[model samples]
Target: NAGVTQTPKFRILKIGQSMTLQCTQDMNHNYMYWYRQDPGMGLKLIYYSVGAGITDKGEVPNGYNVSRSTTEDFPLRLELAAPSQTSVYFCASGRNQPQHFGDGTRLSIL
Candidate 1:
Protein backbone atom coordinates (compact mmCIF):
# COMPACT_ATOMS: atom_id res chain seq x y z
CA ASN A 1 0.00 0.00 0.00
CA ALA A 2 1.08 3.54 -0.67
CA GLY A 3 -0.40 4.62 2.68
CA VAL A 4 -1.42 8.31 2.57
CA THR A 5 0.02 11.19 0.56
CA GLN A 6 -0.66 14.93 0.80
CA THR A 7 0.26 17.54 -1.79
CA PRO A 8 2.27 20.78 -1.71
CA LYS A 9 3.78 19.85 1.70
CA PHE A 10 3.63 23.54 2.53
CA ARG A 11 1.46 26.48 1.48
CA ILE A 12 0.94 30.14 2.27
CA LEU A 13 -2.44 31.79 1.81
CA LYS A 14 -3.61 35.33 2.16
CA ILE A 15 -6.31 36.13 4.66
CA GLY A 16 -9.18 35.24 2.33
CA GLN A 17 -8.03 32.86 -0.33
CA SER A 18 -8.93 29.16 -0.34
CA MET A 19 -7.66 25.80 -1.49
CA THR A 20 -8.25 22.06 -1.25
CA LEU A 21 -5.35 20.07 0.18
CA GLN A 22 -5.45 16.72 -1.51
CA CYS A 23 -5.27 13.33 0.26
CA THR A 24 -5.20 9.85 -1.17
CA GLN A 25 -4.52 6.36 0.15
CA ASP A 26 -3.71 3.21 -1.72
CA MET A 27 -4.66 1.02 1.20
CA ASN A 28 -8.10 -0.56 0.93
CA HIS A 29 -8.96 0.36 4.49
CA ASN A 30 -12.56 1.39 5.05
CA TYR A 31 -11.88 4.12 7.59
CA MET A 32 -10.31 7.48 6.72
CA TYR A 33 -9.81 10.62 8.76
CA TRP A 34 -8.67 14.23 8.61
CA TYR A 35 -7.15 16.02 11.57
CA ARG A 36 -5.42 19.28 12.37
CA GLN A 37 -2.68 19.77 14.92
CA ASP A 38 -2.00 23.13 16.43
CA PRO A 39 1.37 23.86 17.96
CA GLY A 40 2.11 21.85 21.10
CA MET A 41 -1.26 20.13 21.06
CA GLY A 42 -2.64 16.75 20.12
CA LEU A 43 -4.47 16.15 16.87
CA LYS A 44 -8.02 17.40 16.54
CA LEU A 45 -10.42 15.55 14.38
CA ILE A 46 -11.80 17.52 11.45
CA TYR A 47 -13.81 14.90 9.58
CA TYR A 48 -14.08 11.19 9.09
CA SER A 49 -15.93 8.56 7.05
CA VAL A 50 -16.41 4.90 7.72
CA GLY A 51 -17.00 4.09 4.09
CA ALA A 52 -17.88 5.59 0.78
CA GLY A 53 -21.01 7.81 0.83
CA ILE A 54 -20.95 8.14 4.60
CA THR A 55 -19.40 11.15 6.32
CA ASP A 56 -19.67 13.06 9.56
CA LYS A 57 -18.57 16.22 11.35
CA GLY A 58 -15.84 16.08 13.94
CA GLU A 59 -14.52 18.17 16.81
CA VAL A 60 -12.94 20.87 14.62
CA PRO A 61 -15.10 20.75 11.55
CA ASN A 62 -15.72 24.46 11.37
CA GLY A 63 -14.30 26.25 8.31
CA TYR A 64 -13.70 22.92 6.64
CA ASN A 65 -15.72 20.45 4.60
CA VAL A 66 -14.99 16.98 3.33
CA SER A 67 -16.38 14.43 0.91
CA ARG A 68 -15.68 10.72 0.80
CA SER A 69 -16.98 9.48 -2.52
CA THR A 70 -14.40 6.81 -3.34
CA THR A 71 -12.45 4.42 -1.17
CA GLU A 72 -9.16 6.15 -1.78
CA ASP A 73 -9.69 9.92 -1.74
CA PHE A 74 -10.82 12.32 1.00
CA PRO A 75 -10.15 15.92 0.09
CA LEU A 76 -10.55 18.79 2.55
CA ARG A 77 -12.00 22.12 1.42
CA LEU A 78 -11.28 25.43 3.03
CA GLU A 79 -13.52 28.39 2.21
CA LEU A 80 -12.72 32.01 2.97
CA ALA A 81 -9.64 30.85 4.77
CA ALA A 82 -8.59 32.67 7.89
CA PRO A 83 -5.44 32.93 9.94
CA SER A 84 -6.97 30.73 12.62
CA GLN A 85 -7.17 27.97 10.05
CA THR A 86 -3.42 27.78 9.88
CA SER A 87 -2.27 24.41 11.19
CA VAL A 88 -0.71 21.14 10.16
CA TYR A 89 -3.26 18.90 8.45
CA PHE A 90 -2.82 15.18 8.59
CA CYS A 91 -4.61 12.35 6.79
CA ALA A 92 -4.86 8.95 8.42
CA SER A 93 -6.33 5.46 8.41
CA GLY A 94 -6.83 2.34 10.54
CA ARG A 95 -9.81 0.25 11.63
CA ASN A 96 -9.37 -0.75 15.28
CA GLN A 97 -6.04 0.83 16.12
CA PRO A 98 -3.95 3.96 15.95
CA GLN A 99 -3.69 5.67 12.58
CA HIS A 100 -0.86 5.83 10.11
CA PHE A 101 -0.19 9.43 9.09
CA GLY A 102 1.12 11.45 6.20
CA ASP A 103 4.06 13.78 6.90
CA GLY A 104 1.43 16.50 6.98
CA THR A 105 0.37 19.55 5.01
CA ARG A 106 1.63 22.64 6.71
CA LEU A 107 -0.46 25.73 5.99
CA SER A 108 0.13 29.30 7.03
CA ILE A 109 -2.18 32.29 6.65
CA LEU A 110 -0.97 35.84 6.57
Candidate 2:
Protein backbone atom coordinates (compact mmCIF):
# COMPACT_ATOMS: atom_id res chain seq x y z
CA ASN A 1 0.00 0.00 0.00
CA ALA A 2 3.05 2.22 -0.32
CA GLY A 3 3.21 2.81 3.39
CA VAL A 4 5.47 5.84 3.01
CA THR A 5 6.71 7.45 -0.21
CA GLN A 6 9.12 10.30 -0.88
CA THR A 7 9.96 12.03 -4.14
CA PRO A 8 13.24 12.96 -5.80
CA LYS A 9 15.32 10.42 -3.92
CA PHE A 10 18.32 12.50 -4.81
CA ARG A 11 18.65 16.23 -5.32
CA ILE A 12 21.31 18.85 -5.87
CA LEU A 13 20.66 22.51 -5.21
CA LYS A 14 22.57 25.75 -5.52
CA ILE A 15 23.53 27.73 -2.43
CA GLY A 16 20.25 29.62 -2.25
CA GLN A 17 17.96 27.33 -4.15
CA SER A 18 14.72 26.32 -2.51
CA MET A 19 12.91 23.01 -2.80
CA THR A 20 10.18 20.99 -1.18
CA LEU A 21 10.63 17.40 -0.10
CA GLN A 22 7.40 15.56 -0.66
CA CYS A 23 6.16 12.79 1.58
CA THR A 24 2.95 10.83 1.62
CA GLN A 25 1.65 7.84 3.53
CA ASP A 26 -1.07 5.43 2.67
CA MET A 27 -1.46 4.15 6.20
CA ASN A 28 -3.46 7.19 7.25
CA HIS A 29 -1.24 7.86 10.23
CA ASN A 30 -2.09 10.84 12.35
CA TYR A 31 1.51 11.25 13.40
CA MET A 32 3.98 12.33 10.71
CA TYR A 33 7.62 13.28 11.20
CA TRP A 34 10.49 14.93 9.36
CA TYR A 35 14.09 14.19 10.28
CA ARG A 36 17.56 14.86 8.94
CA GLN A 37 20.52 12.54 9.32
CA ASP A 38 24.02 13.70 8.79
CA PRO A 39 26.82 11.43 7.55
CA GLY A 40 27.69 9.83 10.87
CA MET A 41 24.91 10.68 13.26
CA GLY A 42 21.45 9.53 14.08
CA LEU A 43 18.39 11.25 12.75
CA LYS A 44 17.40 14.58 14.32
CA LEU A 45 13.80 15.63 14.24
CA ILE A 46 13.14 18.73 12.17
CA TYR A 47 9.38 18.89 12.57
CA TYR A 48 6.39 16.81 13.49
CA SER A 49 2.62 16.88 13.36
CA VAL A 50 0.24 15.13 15.68
CA GLY A 51 -2.62 15.47 13.26
CA ALA A 52 -3.94 17.52 10.38
CA GLY A 53 -3.69 21.31 10.80
CA ILE A 54 -1.31 20.92 13.76
CA THR A 55 2.46 21.03 13.77
CA ASP A 56 5.46 21.66 16.04
CA LYS A 57 9.07 22.55 15.59
CA GLY A 58 11.47 19.85 16.57
CA GLU A 59 15.14 19.95 17.50
CA VAL A 60 16.45 21.27 14.17
CA PRO A 61 13.72 23.29 12.54
CA ASN A 62 15.89 26.14 11.38
CA GLY A 63 15.74 26.95 7.65
CA TYR A 64 12.87 24.53 7.27
CA ASN A 65 9.11 24.67 7.19
CA VAL A 66 6.35 22.11 7.34
CA SER A 67 2.58 21.93 7.07
CA ARG A 68 0.11 19.12 7.54
CA SER A 69 -2.69 19.86 5.13
CA THR A 70 -4.01 16.32 5.01
CA THR A 71 -3.51 13.04 6.82
CA GLU A 72 -1.52 11.59 3.90
CA ASP A 73 0.83 14.39 2.93
CA PHE A 74 3.47 16.21 4.93
CA PRO A 75 6.02 18.14 2.94
CA LEU A 76 9.25 19.74 4.19
CA ARG A 77 10.32 23.00 2.66
CA LEU A 78 13.85 24.33 2.59
CA GLU A 79 14.17 28.00 1.89
CA LEU A 80 17.40 29.73 0.94
CA ALA A 81 19.26 26.49 1.21
CA ALA A 82 22.78 26.31 2.52
CA PRO A 83 25.64 23.84 2.54
CA SER A 84 24.96 22.94 6.15
CA GLN A 85 21.58 21.61 5.05
CA THR A 86 23.07 18.84 2.96
CA SER A 87 21.89 15.67 4.60
CA VAL A 88 19.64 12.68 4.22
CA TYR A 89 16.02 13.43 4.99
CA PHE A 90 13.57 10.87 6.20
CA CYS A 91 9.80 10.96 6.51
CA ALA A 92 7.98 8.74 8.93
CA SER A 93 4.43 8.04 9.99
CA GLY A 94 2.73 5.88 12.51
CA ARG A 95 -0.08 5.45 14.98
CA ASN A 96 1.99 3.96 17.79
CA GLN A 97 5.38 2.47 18.63
CA PRO A 98 6.18 1.06 15.20
CA GLN A 99 6.78 3.75 12.65
CA HIS A 100 7.11 3.44 8.86
CA PHE A 101 9.78 5.36 6.98
CA GLY A 102 10.37 6.39 3.41
CA ASP A 103 13.61 5.36 1.72
CA GLY A 104 14.93 8.89 2.16
CA THR A 105 15.87 11.92 0.08
CA ARG A 106 19.54 12.74 -0.26
CA LEU A 107 20.08 16.47 -0.60
CA SER A 108 23.30 18.24 -1.58
CA ILE A 109 23.95 21.94 -1.67
CA LEU A 110 26.71 23.59 -3.63
Candidate 3:
Protein backbone atom coordinates (compact mmCIF):
# COMPACT_ATOMS: atom_id res chain seq x y z
CA ASN A 1 0.00 0.00 0.00
CA ALA A 2 1.19 3.52 -0.67
CA GLY A 3 2.08 5.45 2.43
CA VAL A 4 1.81 8.81 0.80
CA THR A 5 1.72 10.04 -2.82
CA GLN A 6 2.07 13.42 -4.50
CA THR A 7 1.53 14.17 -8.15
CA PRO A 8 3.57 16.31 -10.56
CA LYS A 9 6.98 15.73 -9.06
CA PHE A 10 8.15 18.80 -10.92
CA ARG A 11 6.38 21.73 -12.53
CA ILE A 12 7.03 25.12 -14.06
CA LEU A 13 4.37 27.80 -13.79
CA LYS A 14 4.22 31.26 -15.21
CA ILE A 15 3.55 34.06 -12.80
CA GLY A 16 -0.14 34.44 -12.01
CA GLN A 17 -0.84 30.84 -13.01
CA SER A 18 -2.44 28.44 -10.59
CA MET A 19 -2.27 24.74 -9.85
CA THR A 20 -3.28 22.14 -7.35
CA LEU A 21 -0.73 19.78 -5.84
CA GLN A 22 -2.32 16.45 -5.13
CA CYS A 23 -1.59 14.36 -2.06
CA THR A 24 -3.09 11.11 -0.92
CA GLN A 25 -2.31 8.45 1.63
CA ASP A 26 -3.57 4.98 2.32
CA MET A 27 -2.60 4.86 5.99
CA ASN A 28 -5.84 6.39 7.23
CA HIS A 29 -4.16 9.15 9.12
CA ASN A 30 -6.06 11.74 11.15
CA TYR A 31 -3.57 14.52 10.73
CA MET A 32 -2.28 15.97 7.48
CA TYR A 33 -0.09 18.94 6.66
CA TRP A 34 1.49 20.87 3.82
CA TYR A 35 4.87 22.55 4.01
CA ARG A 36 7.23 24.48 1.79
CA GLN A 37 11.01 24.65 1.92
CA ASP A 38 13.04 27.34 0.30
CA PRO A 39 16.71 26.90 -0.62
CA GLY A 40 18.78 26.48 2.53
CA MET A 41 15.81 27.17 4.75
CA GLY A 42 13.77 25.01 7.05
CA LEU A 43 10.31 23.86 6.13
CA LYS A 44 7.52 26.33 6.81
CA LEU A 45 4.07 24.99 7.49
CA ILE A 46 1.57 26.21 4.94
CA TYR A 47 -1.63 24.54 6.04
CA TYR A 48 -2.87 21.58 8.03
CA SER A 49 -5.91 19.52 8.92
CA VAL A 50 -6.58 17.40 11.92
CA GLY A 51 -9.37 15.50 10.23
CA ALA A 52 -11.73 15.61 7.31
CA GLY A 53 -13.67 18.91 7.08
CA ILE A 54 -11.41 20.54 9.66
CA THR A 55 -8.51 22.59 8.32
CA ASP A 56 -6.41 25.44 9.67
CA LYS A 57 -3.91 27.85 8.24
CA GLY A 58 -0.29 27.37 9.24
CA GLU A 59 2.76 29.58 9.56
CA VAL A 60 2.88 30.69 5.96
CA PRO A 61 -0.56 30.19 4.53
CA ASN A 62 -0.54 33.17 2.24
CA GLY A 63 -1.12 32.37 -1.44
CA TYR A 64 -2.02 28.80 -0.65
CA ASN A 65 -4.99 26.80 0.53
CA VAL A 66 -5.85 23.25 1.54
CA SER A 67 -8.87 21.05 1.98
CA ARG A 68 -9.25 17.65 3.59
CA SER A 69 -12.42 15.95 2.44
CA THR A 70 -11.49 12.38 3.23
CA THR A 71 -9.19 10.35 5.39
CA GLU A 72 -6.95 9.65 2.39
CA ASP A 73 -6.72 12.92 0.54
CA PHE A 74 -5.38 16.41 1.23
CA PRO A 75 -4.85 18.70 -1.73
CA LEU A 76 -2.92 22.00 -1.75
CA ARG A 77 -4.07 24.75 -4.07
CA LEU A 78 -1.89 27.63 -5.12
CA GLU A 79 -3.80 30.68 -6.20
CA LEU A 80 -2.16 33.17 -8.54
CA ALA A 81 1.22 31.58 -8.15
CA ALA A 82 4.05 33.98 -7.66
CA PRO A 83 7.84 33.80 -7.93
CA SER A 84 8.12 33.95 -4.15
CA GLN A 85 5.89 30.93 -3.95
CA THR A 86 8.36 28.84 -5.90
CA SER A 87 9.64 26.12 -3.65
CA VAL A 88 9.54 22.45 -2.91
CA TYR A 89 6.21 21.35 -1.46
CA PHE A 90 5.84 18.38 0.82
CA CYS A 91 2.75 16.62 2.17
CA ALA A 92 2.68 14.59 5.33
CA SER A 93 0.18 12.52 7.27
CA GLY A 94 0.06 10.67 10.56
CA ARG A 95 -2.12 9.67 13.43
CA ASN A 96 -0.61 9.85 16.92
CA GLN A 97 2.42 8.21 15.33
CA PRO A 98 5.24 9.76 13.38
CA GLN A 99 4.34 11.41 10.12
CA HIS A 100 5.13 9.99 6.69
CA PHE A 101 6.01 12.42 3.94
CA GLY A 102 5.40 12.36 0.23
CA ASP A 103 8.23 12.47 -2.32
CA GLY A 104 7.60 16.21 -2.81
CA THR A 105 6.67 18.51 -5.65
CA ARG A 106 9.30 20.86 -7.03
CA LEU A 107 7.55 23.97 -8.33
CA SER A 108 9.19 26.88 -10.10
CA ILE A 109 7.46 30.08 -11.07
CA LEU A 110 8.83 32.33 -13.75
- Give a tens-digit lDDT track for model 1, residues 30-82: 88899999999999999988988888898999999999899888899999899
Q: How accurate is candidate 2 locally (lDDT)?
A: 0.95
2 against 3, candidate with superior TM-score: 2
In candidate 3, which residue pairs get closer than 3 Å at backbone N, Cα or C atoms, i.e. clash? none
- In terms of lDDT, the best-performing candidate is 2
lDDT of 1 at 92: 86
Better of 1 and 2 by TM-score: 2
Tell me the spans in candidate 2 whose CA falls farther than 4 Å from its real position. none
1 versus 3: better TM-score goes to: 3
lDDT of 2 at 17: 93
Query: In model 3, how large is the Cα lDDT of residue 85?
Result: 92
What is candidate 3's TM-score against the reference? 0.96
On a 0 to 100 scale, what is the lDDT of residue 102 in model 1? 80
- Our tally of clashes for model 3 stands at 0
In model 3, the runs with Cα more than 4 Å from the true position are none
Per-model clash counts, in order, read 0, 0, 0
For model 3, residues 1-110, the per-residue Cα lDDT tens digits are 78999998999999999999999999889999999999999989999999999999989999998888898999999989999998999999988433899999999999
Tell me, by TM-score, which candidate is best. Answer: 2
**lDDT for each of the candidates?**
0.88, 0.95, 0.92
